[model samples]
Target: MSLVARIATLAQRDAITTTGIVLSGVWLFLVALFWLLAPGGEGTQGGIARLVVMVGTILPLVLIWLAVRTARAIAVLRAEAADLRQRLAQLRDTAAPRGAPRMAEPEPLAEPDRQPRAPAPVPVAPRPLSRPLAESRSPAAPAEGRALDPVDADTLILALNFPDGPDDSLAVSALRRALQDGDHARVLRAAQDVVTLLAGQDLYMDDLPPDPAPPAVWRRFAEGARGSAVAPLGGIHDAAALDIASSLLERDEIFRDTAHHFLRHFDAMLMRHLPDMDDAQIAVLAETRSARAFMLLGRIAGVFG
Candidate 1:
């Protein structure tokens, strides 16, 4: 399903759950109140007793139903978590340093006919995060492209790409480090929360008033990210850096939506133009990576039991 669709579904589920909880609470409270306030006559005793029994029997059943539904929701999240691990692996593979681009464009394909033919197909250009590679790197340690061990590679990646400004990265780093230090449940949960936040966002949530949508949620950001007004093609900003900072602060449920919105735009521009299609490098943290991060994110945010 599309990201937007999934978000809508989660919202619906939340609504249903919340309404059920409220209705059940009200019913139980009213029933209890009636039980205590019943007329103190022998004529009413038997009916009041029967009503208490019915409430007792039905309340447990309702609670059980709610528990089962919650469990199923968690199962869905687990599947998404696995997908994120695979995505991160794929992203790491793509980030492998490729040989420097060979200078000089290939000559136009020789045409047999003299008529004006189309120009040679252009290779998709990479839209590298405008800042230098060093700037985006986390400060704890630096390594010259190291080989990743399935177990430690993720932590290493976290250590390598830490964005210092947000607590999420540090929180994420702690989880990874804990994993490296042999804390499995903690690390796994943390990764899940990050993924959860990215894939689903809990915004102005069920109990809160709505936040108005921005007129151009991303317009100013997109404009400032690349190019000075005078030289759109030549200039670039640290917009990705800003994204790393801002989205981490967003509510965990909807973190994925916020980050992916920007990352997708980056991928479309850089990879969409390539000819072979398969050869272009896209840097979006998507597919499985997104799922993993959300799962971990949920855990860290204290939403996961």
Candidate 2:
């Protein structure tokens, strides 16, 4: 895009520098007008004279500050605008347009999993958290196993971030470090860090408690780690993951390990049977999610024995 387009896009965006530019402009204009309209001090040369002098000095200072502020704002806005234009151009090139952007259409802002027509995001499969447990080494597993990554954990945790929130980069890093250290307990703690954000009544990002709820990378981790068999009983449709995660919030501390372990087993089975299953079969699978959740929480008897 051209320089003007880039500047316009940055001005269109939300940023602190943009606010500074606006306030500076208003102050500069009002002060300049006062300098023209106000009369000069008539030998009132004392404290009042000093106050008048300060006001006159402020005019030049505000002017200089505004000049600096405008230059910085323009520089940042232009850079951001260029970045946005490049992305829009790339998107226009890669994926075929599914349909028009509509009021109810899948938003560009929605998590990548939320898109349906573009491509089939991988169906999840079961696996261990810290290390691959014994049963996972068998021939039945797909030769390559999905690693337990922070990004995936964040995506699974999507129901947790507030609207227009900052990207979940920090949580993703923390979770990844925890996983690399094989400290699964710390990973659970990382997951719990987002509990208040996801469970909060306020939906706006402004009111969010400074930190995003969770990393988007792997928020839907139960399914990401295990696959869909342990997916929230709700389908992966609107608000399904959110509702399911909300339900698990209270029990997460108590059941973290069991939920992780059971999902690993259940996901392996689902992946194998998935080819033979239809929607009816899928519904049955989803319906059992609550029971699976119960089993995780120790409210139900184990069927393995």
Candidate 3:
């Protein structure tokens, strides 16, 4: 049998209850019609009419109760069907392979003459914060033929002081010696000494600690204020130095600013002494074996060939 026919048979249960209820409804209707149309006049006739009226009222109540039960059964069957459909959908979802995409509804076919359009381009996501510092480096430009400035020297000085100023004994000694000698030639020599010390450290510049400050700190540092924290060179006043160093070193900034001490003594000493030296003295200083720092500074300051 078809599904509808099967469900009808289940509700009827061999059709006995359904047939009895239908007969009962028709009987009660007929009896009511008779009583309304024909009124009995005498005592015996009135008693028989009252008996028929009582039977009609009782029959309808029983029929109504059976109808209510049948309706409840149909409602229960509908609920079960709905629950089964939901479970089936859930099972299908669970059974799908781990890597497989979920099945989507099929699209309607287009006109025969039309070709399929290309899919939309997917958006690219940005790199995460944890990406390697090396990958974040900007392309380095050619330094040759480019004129260096005091800013460049200043940036280099900041790079040297990253985390903290030059702690190298040799460079410190030279700086102190120049201060004591008070000679322009000796000051030139001292600048070269500092450069030589930095050059040696440059070999392992990659080994320095990472910049702990955020990009905002670097931005502010570029503006002239030191960073909010201690720098690798050990102070914030020259935070822009981080940018220059990162460019030269071709790495990301990753150093923390700590403590609260402030000093511009190194850059000050260079600025004060560099201007006193004549071109000839600077030239002499640049020619020395340890004169790399002096050459860099002199080129930046336009003081030496």
Candidate 4:
């Protein structure tokens, strides 16, 4: 990006830092102009007054700039720390031992001679064919018989929550599985983008406790209901989280794009499974970290009015 575009992007991501930089530039320019135009003939007292005025004007601006820079540095560190932790966890999972090898079996010579004799065939019962889970559950599935696998669904849910720590082997395994899946991979990537953005702003889905809405409300959302009719689906009401998410959606281009992308995939997945899921399953899904992120972002996006 060009300098101007970079500045614009910075302004969108961190308005306070951009504003401070602009104000500092303008302040310094005005001070320089004043010093250059002012008469030079003055006593020691007059010189001291000028010095004091300059210091007074520059001090507060310097402090503001310092504070903004410090905040930016802290945010960067937090994001880096999170990235490092995730990388370490991934490394641990990758390096983990699979299992012990099986022992070799002894050769069977006498048994081979006995097996030469003809053996009677056993009757087997015919098994019934069934439709894909996705097709059986809802017509809203993206493809006719390409339902999301139950294992994939579980893995996606686990991935959305993210691994709590290096010890969370189950979540790590699920995340790996989700990434390997073609369809689930898209949703995982989108969710990761949004989650990372949210983390940059210090807004973790795990920290936001949303109001528990009924499964029927979630079902309505899955069925395409929006606005006030399904507003309850956006149960996250944390003021700080709402304000930050709302501001980002309105200003940050990257964040807005990822949030929208994540929303679309999540909604599609929900629609495909909600019809077939029981109330308990829906409730379990609603409690997931990804679902919470959805509620927060969906509310900010006005999907729930």
TM-score of 4: 0.51
Task: Compose the digit string of candidate 4's lDDT tens values, residues 1-305.
Answer: 33544454455449767777888888888878987998876556677887999787879788878888877766555555555556434433332221100111222222223342322221111111111101000012223443444443444555555555445565555655455456666776676556656766656666776788999998898888999999898899899999999998998666677789999998887887678766766776677667888999988888898
Candidate 3 residues 38-69, lDDT tens each?
Answer: 87666565777779868667867687767757
Query: Which candidate model has the greater lDDT, 2 or 4?
Result: 4
Per-residue lDDT for 1-305 in model 1, tens only? 33654665577667767766777777678777977997766654587888987978588758855875885587457556655555544433333222110112223323345643322232223212211111122122213453323323233223322222234344334333423332332333333333223223221011111122122312322333322321222111234422443556563324454344434433232232222213111111111222223323322333222
Clashes of each: 33, 25, 20, 0
Q: Model-by-model lDDT, in order?
A: 0.35, 0.35, 0.34, 0.63
TM-score of each: 0.26, 0.23, 0.23, 0.51
lDDT of 2 at 252: 43
TM-score, structure 1 vs. true = 0.26
Which has the higher lDDT value, candidate number 2 or candidate number 3?
A: 2
Error of 3 at 99 (Å): 9.2
lDDT of 2: 0.35
The candidate that achieves the highest TM-score relative to the unseen native structure:
4
- Model 1, position 81: C-alpha lDDT score: 62
Per-residue error at 91 for model 3, in Å? 0.7
lDDT of 2 by residue, 150-229 (tens): 32322222211111112334333232233332333333332222222222222211111111112221223333432343
Clashes in model 4: which pairs? none
Q: Which candidate do you rate higher for lDDT, 1 or 3?
A: 1
